[model samples]
Target: MPASPSPLSSPPPSPITPNLGLVCITVGPEVRFRTITRTRYLSFPEEERAGVLHALYGDNIGRLAGAAAYCVAQGIRLYRMSAALFPMLDLEGDPTGQRVLESLSAELRAAGDAFTAAGIRVLVHPDQFIVLNSENPDVVRRAVYALSFYGLIMDMLGFSRSPWNTILLHGGKGGRAGELAAIIPTLPDAVRSRLCLENDERAFGPTELLPVCREVGVPLIFDAHHHVVREKLSSQDDPSVRHFVLAARATWTPPQWQVVHLSSGIDGPQDRRHTDLITAFPAAYHDVPWIEVEAKGKELALSDLKQRLKPTP
Candidate 1:
């Protein structure tokens, strides 16, 4: 966000070093998109429901595949798909969105082929409410079910079950690691195989999450900006930052290149909000293969970061 306050940021070298990424949505050339709230979606008459869903659901699937073609045109190789790609899929009632997804099997396969053939790496992050560490059983159950649905989406896209096609989630803001640890293995294979935990700015930091990630057998993504805000660190090069980064990296293995996140603060170090462009990166990200650029500028931010990170002769 804005400009960096004199941090020693590293340049990216392809494959061995970080490949900058974009979050959901893009601007400049807007993609036609639609999403409905759970309340509004549930209000449709039973007779009108199927038709409404067919149009709405098919529109998103086309857009999802269309994004890959856009990336190929723009020379972008990394993308995180929209988290709500299949709306209301986790509902407990009859219209759980499964039939629609299955009905659109050919479209899903075509979308999968589009990404794979183009070599655009794909991943997803569940919405914030999908928390596993909640004290409420209902919330936890819903979270588990939601995660399974994410895995299903990845499968529909024909993505391999690996952290490379990760279903990322936060460890919750409550700081209840014990409660979260107890439920990791109970998750279905579709989820557990692709799952990754991230440290948010408020409660979970790499220090708080590393042990649990290690214990639960999942990788932890180092969010460089969040760690700076959470710990009130002066720079990204702090030795402790690298120490924890390596510790988190150790939990990951081959096939899934270790992932990290980079961003500058919206105002300064005190703000959790992301700004239009990222201004600095961390030396600790030296070996991270995937660096999701978390910024409000979307593809603009990602492209700018990559240009600045390019090594100059």
Candidate 2:
């Protein structure tokens, strides 16, 4: 019989099995190399407003490109774009504002191309100012406007109505799920297409938000950490956690992997805050393909989690 091959001659045992699939680690728009500007129309001199706005757009586009490059280097496939991308967008009626929008649109197209080339998934979570179920009509109007603006940005990025490039939002105000369901039909086609609902830590948990999400025909974004903080629900052992995970998974149609958010609670009597690193993995969420790490440490936390999954020699 031929002598057994020496350990050095043996092929490096197939590299550790890759994780279920590509995980989306958030590299949000915060590259330290370039500075981003938040220019408002009234903040600059009347004669210089247009120039100032144009410069801001240039800075943002540069920063976005840098962020994308960073993601590619770090193996991060999912990123959340900044909500303050174009701060004074409401002034688009004026010639200067219109020019800024037009230029930004072109710049975004190029950035989108780079992201698509690298297979990056882009997401946008508008700020809390967006409350679809607010009792005030003005508030609702502003919320709708914000969604439309974000939708426009998505379109410019060449991201069609797909879960891969999603717009996440919390199910607004407790007890208003039905109202939210009702208003879904009234939203513009652009806003409704890319919208995704997420259960909140305090108000709407799966029990309250699932019905609304189903009614509106949008996928749900399950945040495991939020569930644990608010309801003591554990994705590892809680039956309801598994049940809701499947429920949320079902809402996603083909070509869209279920996206879950993972984070660890800070140590405290009633800890709900996200810590820098995840202390435990959601065993039930192992099957989910795309998990967005929301810890304060961001990409560094993801690296730690990946190490945990590596097999011991």
Candidate 3:
């Protein structure tokens, strides 16, 4: 029998402070309401229903930009826009995609400008599918090119795309660290600098992913929810979690900003789902500069965070 690797063998410690933040994802079509609905669901107050409605859909620039604006207005300095922008092109197909991309480019430019003017940082969150397995190389190329346009237009770097099932260690036909090392070097310096790697929710954690980042010289982004879920499943102790956070910090140089994924999870016997926004905030409130809450009622969920960060007498 072979000896199982001790989890402690992962990484050492470092100093970093976690800040408050949220992630924005468009939910549905905007609905107009003349009055407030006094129906309470979950922890959100009914009086704030209108705000919730607006955050989810009202004033949206399609889906991606709207979500970005909603989060920024709520004092969330960091926002993650979905990769749906690219797929929207592919789904619509052809010159339709060309038109859609043009329109999206304009929208992203405007949104990026608004965020920049307001001193907020916006990052385009790319899914692994577009980056790793698009059948058409042009699709992948265009996606990256389009994002680079948005990044340049907005003056922000986008999140890096790693294998989706990385949390599971499945390694299903996607680029691993060494593979990514080769591909990343091929991108233009501007594009490469904007790319950031994130820890997956299923298999890998900062401990597992940071070495890849260290080798490739790309910065790391941590999803605290992912780390917690991994811990609960493995029943690891606090020292282990602390060790991973430290290791992740080691991958970054000074004055480097890191984005963290924060969201509450529902612990069932079988698996954890990012249901609420309660658990993640407290655990990560002191570790990083930006935190993106990936919750169902993100805006309302953020209200909780605002209350927490308020100055006390």
Candidate 4:
């Protein structure tokens, strides 16, 4: 035999070389974030909400601890907590409601502190109900009051709304954007710096949402699934999706990270449902720092993204 090739002729080149260009990493699944949104988890069976949280997050403290632990273990830089918990007042009539709010605020503060200490940022998203209800002046007053107390714990405030609501644009063409700008000023400077707007499943994609965000001086959370839904609903092609992403990029400023949502879609007779499936978008245009997978099988979806995103040195 000609000289046998050395078993390790060329030891694998160093595998840890860093890519000079932007890099995208999948943080984890989005449904995991929804653990706090008991109501949205399922519209019916009101009683199951607590059970679900218990099962997923263990008790409230357990949930916060679990979230903190997850971020630390996975090297995830950011995590989102559902706004459902923020609207603790919804349970106020009950005798325990006040205690619950205090506990929740404490938990949030602890969790936020833990995350920050671990070098991760926690972003809390507001529910659609809050914004729609905020349109009422009375509700606005109450929301502002409640936020004044609990807002201290969060690093970023996310607002996700339905398309119809955006169409109305509460104040003008830039509905929630305008509302956020007006209301954010009322928030303590600490909270205002953390505000962010998310794109919903409705017709309004980043293209429509970015203008409003720019006017208000906040960043945008581009939910990939929402863009997919908009593309399918509007019958647009790949170019449309690319356009939307580019538009969002234009609005982003430095030091204010970009958070994007990723998931799959199930095509039904009339519409497509956002499923937890990961796909590739050329890395040439966008380098997302955080991606939340909005799928039913959250962990499984996360694993899939990991495999797909493995470093290729």
Q: List the residue pairs that clash in candidate 2.
A: none
lDDT of 4 by residue, 111-207 (tens): 5567557765555555444452245787776555545433543432122222100111212223455565666556565445555667766635676
Residues 1-313, candidate 3, lDDT per residue (tens digit)?
1122122121223254334555445333321112222232223654653344333322334444554456555666665554433322333222333443444455545655665555565565654544532446776576556545434433322222321101111111234445545566566555566666776655456665676678767667666556667666543224555566566666656524655566655553124565543433333235556656666655555565556544443
Name the candidate that leads on TM-score: 1
- For this target, which candidate reaches the highest lDDT against the unseen true structure? 1
- What value does the lDDT take at residue 221 in candidate 1? 84
- lDDT (Cα, 0-100) at 147 in candidate 1: 87
| TM per candidate | 0.92, 0.84, 0.63, 0.63
How would you order the candidates by lDDT, starting with the best?
1, 2, 3, 4
lDDT of candidate 1 over 66-178, digit per residue (tens): 88888788777778888988787777776547887889978988987898998888889988999888888889888888888888888888998888788998888466988
How many clashes show up in model 4? 4
Per-candidate local distance difference test: 0.79, 0.70, 0.48, 0.47
Better of 1 and 3 by TM-score: 1
How well does candidate 2 score on lDDT at residue 39? 49
- In model 1, the runs with Cα more than 4 Å from the true position are 1-17, 30-32
Report the alpha-carbon TM-score of model 2 versus the true structure: 0.84
Candidate 1 matches the true fold with a TM-score of 0.92
lDDT of 2 at 202: 86
